[model samples]
Structures are given as C-alpha cells and as structure tokens.
Target: MTTAAHPLVVRARQLATGLLGPHAERVDQEGVPASHVKALKGSGLLGVNAPTEYGGAAAPPAVARDTAEILAGACCSTWFVLTQHYTPVKLLASTELPVRERLLGPLARGELLSGIAYAHVRAFPRVPVRATPERGGWRFDGTVPWYTGWTLNDVMLLAGVSEAGEVVFAFTEAREQPGLRPTAPMRLAALSAAHTVSLELNGLWLPRDSIVLRTPQTKFAQVDRPRNTNASPAVFGVAYAALDLLEAAPEAKETAGSLRSRLDEARREAYALWDHPVPHERIEERLAWKLRAHDLLRTTTTAALVAGGGRSMALGSRAQRLAREAMFLLVQGQTAEVRQAHLGHLSEIP
Candidate 1:
C-alpha cells in the first residue's frame, strides 16, 4: 500500500488523513485511544529521525519536520506522544554509553515508546530535580512538574542537576517504582488526550550504564539555545488547517487569502533560517518569524471559529478543536527568552 516516492512521507500522510484526522475528536475526548497508537506503531514514522542501522527510517531533517507538521495538524495529542521518543533516540545515538546497545534498537524499531521527564531541568536555578552520587549509580530526588505520556510510555528519559552543577540524564522504567510516584493524568485546555502527569522522585536510583548524558549545565544551555529559538513547523500546519476551514466558507475567502499569503512567507523564512549551515546563526530573525507565524495562526484559527457561526460552539467541531490547539501551541516549547519576547511584544501594543 506504500509508494516508492518518499515512502515514509507517503505513509504518514495517509495515516494522518485517514486514521488520525478522522478520529482526532474522539481521541481527544478519550485521551488517545489504544488503537490509534497501534496504527502509529505500524506506520514506521516513529523512527523517522533515528539512525538507519537501528531500524529507523532515518529520513532527512526536512522530511521529519514535514511529518510533524502533518501529524500535529491531524492529531496533536498523538504527535506529542510520539515526539517524545525521538529525543531519547538522538541522545542514545550521540552518547557512547553502554545502554545505547541495549535500548536504541528497540526504541528505533518502535517496539518501545519513551516519554520525557526532563523539562524540569530547564528550571536551572530552582533545581526542580537533583542528583546525588550514590554507590552504584546516582540518586535522584525532587519533583517533575510535567511528564507526558504517563501510562502510555514504556520508559522515560529523566534528567536532573547534579550536586556539582552538571546535568545528568538517564533512561528508566516509566511505570511506578520504589521511591518514584506519579500523579494522575492532568486535564488541560488542550491536548489533555496526551495523558500528562507530574512525577515525584524520592531517592530514585539508576545504574551508571543507564545514564546517557552528563555534562556541565552550561553546556546543555549552549546546545539548547538554538533549538528554543526556532519556530515549530506545527504552527504553520495548524494555521493552514484553520485556513482550510476558512477557505470553505464564501464570506471568509478574502481574509483567508491574505492570511495564507502571510503564513507562507513567514514559513519560508523560518524554515530557511532553521536549515542554515550554522546552527546558532540568526536567532533573532528566527524568533521574529516565530512570532509572526503565531500571529497568523491566532488570526486564522479565530477566523475559522467565527466563520463556523453557531456550529462552532459544538465541542466536536473542527473549528473549535483547531482554536484550542492554537492556544496550546502558543507555549508548547516555550523558553524564558521566548516567553519574555512574546510577552514584551504583547505589552507594546498601543
């Protein structure tokens, strides 16, 4: 059922348009049904960014980005669940740790799914999670405020700051274990179907081999800067979906036309900056494009909702769903600098 021309892309588009898009509303209400995840596993898109030697598609960066755009536009909850798997794959591929041999193959093959409990590390000075040297490994203690894919993941990439100010990351069983506790999944304004939870680690320990990365916290910051500055392609995808809705209505054609033109312009600029040879160049321009894209996203989604008239008020309406997703993307991968810039930009509006 797959074609030779970009098989992974072709498959992802088919899954997005068929299984994911048709069932998104129900999946959102049900918090990502099991059948949907099973379809995703068979799609082979989960391994898009992993190394080919490890059974991943090993698609190009642009291919991965386009796949994300398609999936997020179809069903963000499902996209988020799978997105967490890529980071650990990247970490394992980059690190020379012994655990790489143990986990990378299975994860890349989609035989196992992983979630991230590492965002708390971004709260640097606060030290939300801390690691102390122990006999055979390291002991982790403190709280993780946001851990998505709770019961759905097989493992998690957990991170904490060491007493010596180093960032330590390790893979651990995602289930409840001694000294590790998880709160029930949270309900949010959007993407609640992702099954997010908070984790509390009290003397949780991981063997030395399980530890994937350990470097000075400053080094992590250096690697993290360029990533946070880039615009997410999902922003463009979701905005386009709303534009599609607006385009269907005769009255909103002109508004949709103008926003579509602006969206394409900003998207090209953002993608070009993101793909530049230098990883850290033109960060300011990248952020500018990000804000511009977000503005367009807001305008398009709101217009879609307005154009839907009284029907938009229904909980299952695409216009309503897209509107809520727009809210979620506004802060999905937020950093302190991005937050400051976004808020500052809003404050300047006369």
Candidate 2:
C-alpha cells in the first residue's frame, strides 16, 4: 500500500522537481548553486520551519522531515546545505525575542542566508574560538574548517570560545571586512557541490549585538537527544532513492526488502521518541535508534552498489553520489566509536 503525501510534502516534491531537478546533477559537482539557492528563496521554502510570528511557516517537525527527505532525494548536495541552515535556524527559533528580532525574520525572508562552522576534527584543539572584550562588542579570532555553503550564505552561525571560556554562538555577516577570507574548497569523495569552505578570521570585530545566543553549559541530554529528528526524514528519502535504484537489479530485491523493514521500524521508534519523554538513562537507547537508522541507510545504499557491479561506481553516477552523501550520516555530530560507546552505556543502563 502507498502512503499518501501531506499537502506541504506534496508542495515540496513539486518544487524540488520543477526548480531543483534540472540542476541537481550539476549542483552535486559544483557545490551549492547560487542561483538554485536564490530560486529556493523565491519559492518561499527557505522559511519552511520558521515560526509564523516571524513570517515563517512554523512547519511541524514531521512536516519539515518530509520536506527535507523529498529535497534530498532530488539533490543531496542542495539538501545538505539546506538542512544544515534549517537546523541552526530551528535552534535560533528557541532563543529570546531580541535574538529572533535581530536574526530570524531576515533569515526566513531569505534576505540573509546562513551556514554553520563547528569544530569536528579530533586533532584540532578543542579550544573555543576566543572572543575578547572590546569597546562596543567583542573581537573574534580563530579558524573554522568545513563551513558548509560558505559561498552561498550571507551570514554564518559561528561556534567559538568566549573570553569567559564558554562555547558561544556568534552571528557573523559577510561584508567588506579586511580579515575574513575563504580558503580553497576541499575536495571530497561526495557532496562536493555543497561548497564547504574553511574560514580565517584575523582579529575580526563583532559588536556585542552580534552575539545571538550563549550556552554557559549546554544540556546535551536535551540538545543531543532531538538532534536526529530533523535529519532523519531526509535519510528516509535517501534510503527510498537507493531502493528505487536497486529495483532494476534482480539480486537487490531481498536486501531492499530488509532495508525497507528496518527503515519503517526506525521511523516508528523515532516518532515515538519525539512524543515521549526521553529519560537521561535511555540516552544510549535513543542513540541506538538513530544508529540503526544510519546503518539501514548505509546498508541499503551499499547493496545497490554491489548489485549494480561496476556501473554504479562510475563517475557522475547517482549511486556513487548517494554513497558519498551517505558518509555524512556516519561522521556527522558523533563518530562511530562514540556512538558505539553510547550504545554500550545504554545497554548497561538497567
């Protein structure tokens, strides 16, 4: 039996096909297309998850998930940047009124596009990007590698260390600043079209007003717990796409069936978690649900590749691209080892 699409999800699918479909392949190779991002702005999709008070749709999490999955199925690179921007905005939506007034409206209206640059590498000193007190606001100096969609965004949600040694988020707009420079884009196995860039700040001055939110102590139990809900929907789309591709291969039928079943189970568990209180003791259990979702996606895509033989890995193939984008599922937020440890902790949480 086929599932019926919600009106909003139906709209998202139509928009993806009409505007983003023609350029999806090029976007995968060229990074986020500036024109495509602009077109999305015109479509009023940029504000899909924004609160209506700020001129946003105030889309529910499930609706947002459906939208993202549809978009990702059409173009993984575009959806990657789009989802990254939306996630930060979702966090911003939960902030104070002043912060929303200063940032959200412009963000939703697409007058401002934003990106995130968080520290992810292991060898990198876990030092927060230092922000020193200044006359009017603060002066920031540090580097953030892998700032996704840098070229396309007018603003960035930069995570840095404050003078007080707190992890702070600063909204830095791109302007004619002397110190800010974008480095050469990094070549990657997949999602190259997302235009991820490294940023260098040479004693950049940001007014105190630029500080949007600060977390003196981040409640990871709350923060990390719901992190996957938004992205999970898009993952579902990727799995669906892989399954669609695998349908042409006779050997892939069994693998595809298994993947579909696992995906359905993960979706049920994830939505259930969204409704219920996630106990601190079950943090690992929650993580397990997310990991299982990740594995099912990976396995489904891998099976597609294997079933297709040499053709699937050819340059410019969608299968190859999906495989590469799927890697993000593995490395994002937490590493495999970290996730495994959390799962172990959850098992012992009796």
The 0-to-1 C-alpha lDDT of every candidate, in the order given, reads: 0.88, 0.70
Off by over 4 Å in 2: 1-7, 19-22, 97-99, 119-125, 220-222, 225-231, 277-281, 335-350
Worst 10 residues of 1 by lDDT: 1-10
Stretches of candidate 1 off by over 4 Å are 1-5
Q: Write the per-residue lDDT of candidate 2 for residues 51-91, one digit (tens) a residue.
A: 88877777666777778888887887888777667856776
Query: Clashing residue pairs, candidate 1?
Result: none
Model 1 RMSD in Å is 1.9
Global local distance difference test of model 2 = 0.70
lDDT per residue (tens digit) for residues 1-350 in model 1: 32235778788789989899999888878888777778877788878888999999888778888888888889888888988888999999898889999999888888888999888777787799999889889999999999999888999999999888999999999999997999988999899999999999999989999999999998898788888788887888789889989999999999999999999999899989889999878888988888888888899999999999999999899999999999999998788989999998778867
Going through the candidates in the order shown, the clash numbers are: 0, 5
**TM, every model:** 0.97, 0.86
